[model samples]
Target: MFEGLKVVVGLISFILVYRTVTGNCNKYLAFAICAIWLRFFLAAFHTITYPPLIVGFSINALGSISVACLGLLVIPTPVFTLKKFFPFFLFFVCIAISGFVNMKIPGTINVLVKWCYFLVLASALILSVRVQGQNATFKKLLVAFTMPVALQILSVVLGQAKATEADGSASYIGGYNHEAAFSMIIVSFIFVVGLIERGTLSFRTSLFTLSVFLLVLVNYRTSILTILPIAAVFYFTLAEQRLKPSQKAPVMMIVAMVLLSSFLALSFTMKERFADIGLLLSNLDLMLKAPIYFSDAERDIMSARVYIWSQYIDAFRNADLLNQLLGFGPDSWKGRFNLYAHNTFVSYIYEYGVLGVGSFVFVCISVLLNALTLKDRKLSKILALSFVGFLAMNMATMPLWNIEGLIFFAILNAVLIGHKKSSKSRQVSTDNRELLNAN
Candidate 1:
């Protein structure tokens, strides 16, 4: 009976995906995003300590390989759409180059596969929006996104979280393996959800926003930097909609007060995080430059991020000119230190070197600029703000390094690409109209 039920559910899901993509877009990109919820669901089993279970590893790589193979199927890539993100393409090229130079084929292929995943996923989503229409596409996205997040929250609140901090504190990551990635996803969720449902702060919206603040209060304090500005934008926009021009200042004050109050109310619980601010400020210079080595005493500070980042920085400083410009290679830090760089920028500079990090920064700048010029001004403003938050995140953690961060981006960017071209979707046969030309 259980096996039959599994097959029935699989069939239903397959049918739903088929209808959603209109038989043109392949299923894996959507399946991968859908699988993210599954990853978190599997985390529940990991949370079990009674007998111990080893669930499947993340499917992000599998998803990437699957969609990337679409290129092998002769579907032309959306080269036109991808041109807008050419800098990112350069970043990928740099990674592959660094890998070949360093002779790390597995590491090189891994990053390349993820890039291909993003490429094909973006193409598929853009086609879905064009074929399924904005409301339906976003509705499907909302449901897909909402479940994992809600389940994650429930897991944390119930104390089933398997994630912990370097200092052995509860991170409240719930189903996520890391707190920073979860926090980044929260930021993305706010932006994407708001994009789908825009209006004054309904009771539900206000409550959801408050819940996010509370959740962050208990874990990943740095995320607060990104959340504050983005949340303020959304909340203040409500003030604009309802208040008179003369009342704008007071409404802004109120928004600030609301955010402040949320922080203050939870201050007692996050005393350690607040202290980290002082720790970082006091050691600002050392944080940037130090010897490639630290004693055990120094390694315990700032959750060892200070020591961890310094090793990466000092190595980059001492690297040969060629490696300095091109980077040592993908995941090179792991071989030396047996650890990932806690800071994304620091990691990129050491691993991919100047060319890789520069291309990444350029991509961020170009995307932000183009976001403003988008015909859909509302989406432009929200997404640009969200991207800022995402950047703030990258300063401390590698949001783009994880699958959750990529999922929301693929959705929002797909909307940005297809919303305007929606008219052209009607030009071809229903079957071929929204087809992915995945180059």
Candidate 2:
């Protein structure tokens, strides 16, 4: 509820400022900053709480309200097709069906509600992207979205100084657990938004730089260790191949240094024991077998998940031909097994069976291809990095299953899928028009 309050206030503040700016757009951006700041704080603070609730509706409310705002903004002016948003609507329908079919579990209804919240967030973000113009509104949206990174930085600081030294602390930060997954997902969102906004305004670029610094402090070792190096290599190689010779050297140098510095800083902080890899690995090997690391009690909980997954697999495999095609129903899984799949892919398979999985895979591939089609060399590189980094982060932890992570991924996919080929085209058109008039 505390978190819910923050979100509600943030949205009201943003709406008030949006009204006050009188079309300035920049003031509206300040409102976005406040909203995002509140969101990040709530998400970071609540990561440890089970069945995370909307304590302060502020974090949850803004996205839904913002979607409505986008709808209103675009209804008066025609920037993008409202129909382009239909696929997203279809995607949510699938999620709803999945939830209802699996409703037998203890908290299945709550999960569905959370799913609805995430869908609203995804819609809001996608709508915001669609409504973007040369106007300042889109920039403000990105600025507001970046606010979460600030909260992550604070969490990382606290997490670093006093990480939990026990196993149930799976949700604690900088502890090589799931919290790191959430942190990395939020950082990836910030990183991509920064890249997109780099040329928008000097102030925005400065904010981008600040975001990078804070991201370093947020220190999710797995993502930092992988994304930094991969992004650097991708940036330089892609830039060298794509940009003009004159434009290559400067960008490469700047990107390289930022990635390197961030990588080193994060690595040093979270992985002090990794300072001695051989010893750390040997100790980790023993730790895995120790009572504290894999206690009987903890093992039992994990084993229960295994049991649930097994039941899901058996149910599907043994289903008759028709049931296999249509699926068991959304709430069916919860009723049948008393558990939600902790694994996202498993969850999808349980709900939709093969056909649903196929459709999901199709959407994913479309997003990937769309990202590849991005013409802006910089935006292209950023999306590529995010896709790879995000996928890797999700392997060990359930980013897709986490509400915050779901919003982050869905928004990111929308950005990648809906991002228009502009900036360069607009610049060239402006230059050509000026030349013709001069002649």
Candidate 3:
């Protein structure tokens, strides 16, 4: 009976989220759909059978192919010269060669799953841009992206209540193993929403402040600390408000001095909490302990990541041209029991080899480039900060490789990328246009 209930609930949740993402049918909704699917696939993989691998791979490969086809269907065929195509081609080739040469194909199913994910993501991005001409469309996309998250938050709160009442623990299913990471992802989205919704500073500040407090409760120090400072800097930099000419230089100088002093003080205070804040507020010392404790684990669990990375590096060294392309096919890292490289850099190397890594890096660079191109001051700051957070969070962990991590990264990417195009409207733009666009 319990099992039946679980299945029923899962189905309902899945349907709700899917409709939330695709019903409005914007490009961003497509991105949201893919992000949710990535979470589903990763979660479902652990529970599903092995023989079904072929079926899963076929479905996902078709999805990727479909994305490329769909993009062509909607948008102008992205003109590709040999110069542009050659580099892209070679990059995939290197990834394939490295994986095949190393025989890192045990997790073939997982790789296929990711391919499907990327395919869907690509398709969603294309759709999002195409539907941009409509006003109601983007609002629907944002609502689709956010409303489910709001529901999830409510569900979590209810679960927490039930757990407390029953003296039992509540677990989030569907690829969410790390509660801290999952909470951080949700918080990241809220941060994005706050950016899109322009109101008084007090309102925005209160929202982010509350978010920071909740983050502390969740104890995702890496993401909270990383994202908060970046978000603040990004927000302030992009904000339209500026000091008068007389006060500007002195204010800037004071701020610069405070920042410099703080950095120097932090560097000296490493591994020790700063005296000013209590256990709840000060995290610099705690940040140092994860590595230290993990490094000292009895079974050497943390070192396992190093061992896997070593094997991958050696494989990359031996890889050749054709094998270097297209990747060793997906899910190439299964059976190792080590879910990720514990580092996004290592994860990229193992999954895409050098080529896929290059492409991934290229995409990040593209986002950064587009961030600068943003017309709206607030939107640009938010994109820049999101990117910074995305990159920063990877320092200690690979949220991108895991469901909890990927959801945050994927949603943020979808929203920020959407902002890049939508921010084109200037202050003098049509009121009708203003009413239609969300960002």
User: What TM-score, computed on C-alpha atoms, does each candidate reach?
Assistant: 0.78, 0.59, 0.57
lDDT of prediction 2:
0.49
lDDT of 2 by residue, 134-181 (tens): 224345455444334433444455554334323322232322234444
TM-score of 1: 0.78
> Distance (Å) between predicted and true CA of 114, model 2?
5.8
For candidate 3, write residues 56-172 as lDDT tens digits. Answer: 544434444444445344432332221222333454455555556656654543443443344335334433543453233333433333333433444445543222112233433
Model 3 earns a TM-score of 0.57
Give all candidates' CA lDDT scores.
0.63, 0.49, 0.47
Least well predicted 10-residue stretch by lDDT in candidate 3: 160-169
Which regions in candidate 3 have their CA more than 4 angstroms from the true location?
A: 1-93, 96-109, 112-116, 126-130, 133-139, 142-176, 180-184, 194-214, 233-332, 336-339, 350-359, 373-378, 403-439
Q: Tell how far residue 255 is off in model 3, in angstroms.
A: 9.7
Model 2 ranges with Cα > 4 A deviation = 1-23, 26-90, 93-138, 142-185, 197-230, 233-342, 422-439
Off by over 4 Å in 1: 1-60, 70-76, 79-81, 130-135, 166-169, 199-207, 210-218, 244-249, 263-269, 292-298, 375-377, 419-439
Clashes of each: 6, 29, 20
